[model samples]
Target: MIDEQTRSLLAGIGGFDPTPGALAGVVVVDVTRVVAGPYCAMILADLGATVIKVENPDDPDYTRTFPPLLTGEGSEPLSGFFAQYNRNKLGVTANLRTAEGRELLERLVARTDVLIENFRPGTMERLGVGPDRLREANPRLVYAALSGYGQHGPYRGRPAYDNSAQATGGLWSMNGPAGGPPTRVGTIIGDLAASLYGAIGVLAALRHAERTGEGQLVDISQQDSVVTLTENAVVAYTTEGTVPEPLGNAHPFVRPYELFPCRDGHVFFGGYTDKFWRISCEVFGGEGTADAHADLSDMATRFDPDVYRDRVRPMVEGWFRDRTKAELEALAGDLVPLSAVKDIGEVVDDPQIAARDMIVETEYDGYGALRTFGSPVKLDVTPPRTRGRAPATGAHTAEVLADVLGYSAAEIDAMRQAGAI
Candidate 1:
């Protein structure tokens, strides 16, 4: 348990409000590292779960050394990447190779509502803390495993990273410009999508456990998650016998639904629907242009490849070429869907993002204030939030041992001295 003084200190930090969150009474054992599992656990932590991050004492989570390092005089360098996903969690160390360490993990599982991990399949079984054993110890424990493949697939034993998952999951095949080489996504969507699914599974399992006193494994595969996000590409192939290929900035079936260059920057214009197309004609081309394109107003005609290529595309391109993003937005008003293609800098300072509290600040002791993306899951009464900064390695080992597991100070000291913490 955090002392009052320590709680006060933490509450003083930016984004560390003490309001009780939706998952306030839940405990999560985060036996994860790097992106996928840690991010899933972080989502629970942000919702006010008391998350205990367990790591090996000698060989901690390697992402703790990830880039954008923060260094201060007489202080250890901290990883901004790690901090971005690990905030609002306590830290503990347990080297699962040893009997004492494994026992420590069992104790933690016995007391936790959820235990999440992302090691390659069977790593926990090798460590003697597999889901079967842990769930046997606590029948109501939600065991969530996030991995590149899954726990029981042919590729379960194979090693995979984000790119590997994307490649295998069919995202790479459908992600590049038309007629160009297949390309991996710009971000780690494979891992992130799996994390989201894992979180959803955990919440659902928690609800089941609450009603039935039964817990189950949430097996989330990055490849499977990525496949689900292919946006009808698989169906397009299976039904029509046509392999989906990248269409660059344009929608596969939507004519004139793509990015167009403006006087200042690019803007995405979705004038595919008849209503929006009419609005676009009125705003950009006026009545004369609308009359000229009267036959193209029919959805079937506009969606035809030859019609779009020879007629619709030329006119839409011409309409946007002379206008700025702001002017196009003004013309669009609420009649059409249009948006400027904002870079990261512009997005960071965007008024809509600011108004929605999509950017938030978190303060570290020596690091001052660091801003990161805020939670997209907003709850009215029990809003999810960053409760505090990420903990240093094993920072709360003794506290958690004593407070949650009912361990004495001397026992914790002994475990630390024995290199089992």
Candidate 2:
């Protein structure tokens, strides 16, 4: 059961309470902009943490001005991109350049359990809220910093985005075709990966703080996070002196592990072992089962690139090219591992994803209803829920000032007149 104070807090902020999530009573002060830091804070918010998103009144998060705006008939417009990452948060505008603004932030930090920021290495220190200062105010606050490069390094002060981090961290080199030009990933994986790691670090630090009454800084680098996705690139180079390159859609080690062109679209299938290979031969119905191809039955022979490219893939491609997606599904049944390549529209409308509530409809003040991706981590006991829509710019400014900071109406108006919030 939720406490009356928590229920009133939720009601005052226009937040919903679908289920009691893991971080019900936790408070997060999110002074982050752009994708990485906001995403980390959103993850905590999804788990029922009360996240207060701090934005500068002069220069708000850049995404607030981005395109694809959702507007009501008479209300203001809101950016869909901003709403996607900043959901279930209380938005506040504070001019950090002013003394009053920093005082407000200091007050919020004193009672917050966690704080997330993605500014450059020394930016927080310049704002007079560095780790040392924050620790003095609240020793048990879990402070997290998400950056392109880590806090201490040669490239710490250098600027980097998702593309830069991907290029510097070997993802660009390891992607694309075997001999083709370097290609960027379709999405901002570098920033997103760093956010996930940063969120995990915050959770762990919070647990530590809960037990020992001490908190530490969590520093996550986008470049470092992107490097972890290079499947076995490091091991191949360090152990065998082999620098791996992209093999298109095919696996470097597994044979028949590639995308095949079908009649209408594409399908990816894999069958390496004898049992599955025999099943694959039946479904493919080609020279893959001939006596001349007997040597290819062994996993080693199939693992050979020449054998796979010259003999195996050709047969499979020919078979798949002649069959439709439905026919192949019926023919293969569940014996073989196979799935048709789907586009974004197909994925969004997929029955499996729909059944699992992967896409949900949430309502905002200006935007009546918006469709957004739901949380992937689902716990049986206390599953995370999307309580409410993303807030408008500085929507909870007065409410937060009154409830959290105990600022009277006159004081709030005075600060606003001073251009502090």
Candidate 3:
């Protein structure tokens, strides 16, 4: 039940009631496998596009066979890996090698609004269904290619995964401690970023097609996407002739902006400005502490590397070490930017996360009900939703051919006999 205030807030905004996706009538043919491509298609599916996962019969998505299968007494074991990123989709098999398969794909392309693939650069063209040929068939189709090195580059042919992208894009250099060896981020940021950029490109291209009925290609490379995230490092190298070294958890230009030790674990506090610095000093002690930091009153002096190393950081560390995380949060609630470093368990139970519905429960076909992440993108109207569990391999092949393509039962059986689906 919603309160009066909450009800009123939702009443003014349309699309609050659950409905079909925002991209409802848009048809997407996802020919990509693996994280980046499947992740992008998943976002589109969440937004209400009717996405058909086009897989080859010989090697279906490897994730579909990945380990940690969910099993029950009367159900076929399902791959949790595939289910994670392939939710809310209709699955089909198209051998692309056979003439009948190619014909079927061509027919699907003729009616599709968007087709995405993340195979090697020339794989699609070699398959006789490249962007140029598909666009010729459907003038308003958005052809999106997500690759490791992009369509054309000196390293275009080089194979890459999340690890290689992070290394090649210079993200590995700036991570970890000052003198420590390079570190990979715990999460797969490179792959995830590429998907986000690819999704944005697809949406923008769809808008352009909607207006003029002319479609274009969207090319996104994981290496390039990771490089874009090295904004400060690029600027420093180009403009200042400086090579930045890792400062552990510290910000490059801000003092008191790093993680600090607390009684139980770790906490982060930011008191970069003079006003916050003075208040922080008062909180630490009072007049004595203020006098000690009097020379570091201005922003320039406060952030100076030498001053921060010799004085500010040590003082802050010592002050933080004396207090518990809860104590510091209470004392500096709104006075300074402070946060406790929470683990995964804490994050799951966090009040703010619960309030925002950042984690939601979804029912997997064979796995029963499980908790998965909710969409971070919140549109007061037309919010993204999880349609259902990920489909079984070629689960919709017969259904789609019959209902969507208007094929007769005999035609569907013939195609199956010929191994075209």
Candidate 4:
């Protein structure tokens, strides 16, 4: 159960409701840093898990120094980038290199429902706090490991960043213009996908633990996660002997399903299906255009490379060239299946995004209201929400140690004196 003080703090944050969250009583020990692992823990935290974020005292999460900082009264500037993924977590620091720090971690793990980490494959084991040891201590503990490769693969020990994962996982090879050099994705899709998958795996493991009282390991690989998103690209090569290549913003097998340039900006048109194609023809190609192109009504004919390149592309480009994004967007509907391509600035103010409460603001003690994203998962009874500002380094160390592990003030002080925290 969350203590009253903690609950009050959460309530003060933006987007919190009086109702208890879905994972209210669950305890999570987040021993991860940076994007992938932190993001996974953040998802659980948003769902009301009591996530205790543990960092190494000597070398904290490097993202803590990332740009776009925020400063509160008498506190060092905090990274908005770090805050984006670390909110709603109690922060604590422990120098795991010391025996005292390792002991503290063991105690915390014994009481934790889930433990997530993103260190290299054997880093935890070398520190003597690996899954085998911790899960032995607590039979119902769910241990999740997020890494670039998995725990047992040949490349498991190799270092990887988002671009490295994208490159090695085959996503980069197929991500650019048809004949252009391979390009990295604009966002960290590799890390984000792995984090999402890691969260799902942790949830599934938690359910299993609840039913059988048995703990398990959830090993998520960024490379594997990225490969899963390739969406039939591998199967196409294996089954039909056709290697996939980049098509820029166009769909590999769908015609008129790509972004089109307009007078002011761009709009994505999705006339791939027969029904939507007819609707698009009526809207863009004018009144009798659908009938005039009756011979190309079938997908096979319209989607053929030669036909699309020579006929359909030119016609669609001609239709879009004279129109403005707003003019094209006005025709968007269920039948048309089109929308204006939105930049970040436009997305923040979009009515649909606003209606969904995707943009949320949280107030810090001295820093004014800071806006970040809202939870995508919405449950009527116990909704997931962003419930607080990110903590300062080890801000909740004394509180968590006392409340969670039943440590005395003297013991905490002794450990602090020894530089264990």
Instruction: Write the residue-wise lDDT of candidate 3 on 321-355 in tens digits.
Output: 97888788888867888888889898889888988
Q: Write the per-residue lDDT of candidate 2 for residues 1-421, one digit (tens) a residue.
A: 2235644564467456646688887888899998999999999988888888999988889998677788886355778788889888899989878889988988888777899999989898998888888988888989999999989999999988999899999999878887797788889999999999999999999999989989899999999999999998989999999987866787879888878889989888887777788778865675545454677778888888888879888878877888887788778847788887889798899887898888888876545888878899888887887646777778899988888678999999999999999
What is the clash count for each candidate, in the order shown? Answer: 1, 0, 1, 0
| Worst lDDT 10-window in candidate 4 | 9-18
Best by lDDT: 4
Q: Candidate 1 on 260-311: residue-level lDDT in tens?
A: 8889999988888888888789888887777787998898899999998998
lDDT of 1 at 415: 91
Q: For model 2, which pairs clash?
A: none
Model 2 spans with C-alpha error above 4 angstroms: 1-11, 286-293
In order, the Cα lDDT scores of the candidates are: 0.85, 0.84, 0.80, 0.86
Question: Which residue runs of candidate 3 sit more than 4 Å off their true CA positions?
Answer: 1-18, 67-69, 74-76, 284-292
How far does residue 256 in candidate 1 sit from its true spot (Å)? 1.8
Residue 92 in model 3: lDDT: 83
In angstroms, the error of model 1 at 320 is: 1.1
Greater lDDT among 2 and 4 belongs to 4
| lDDT winner, 1 or 2 | 1
Candidate 2 Cα RMSD after full superposition onto the native fold (Å): 2.4
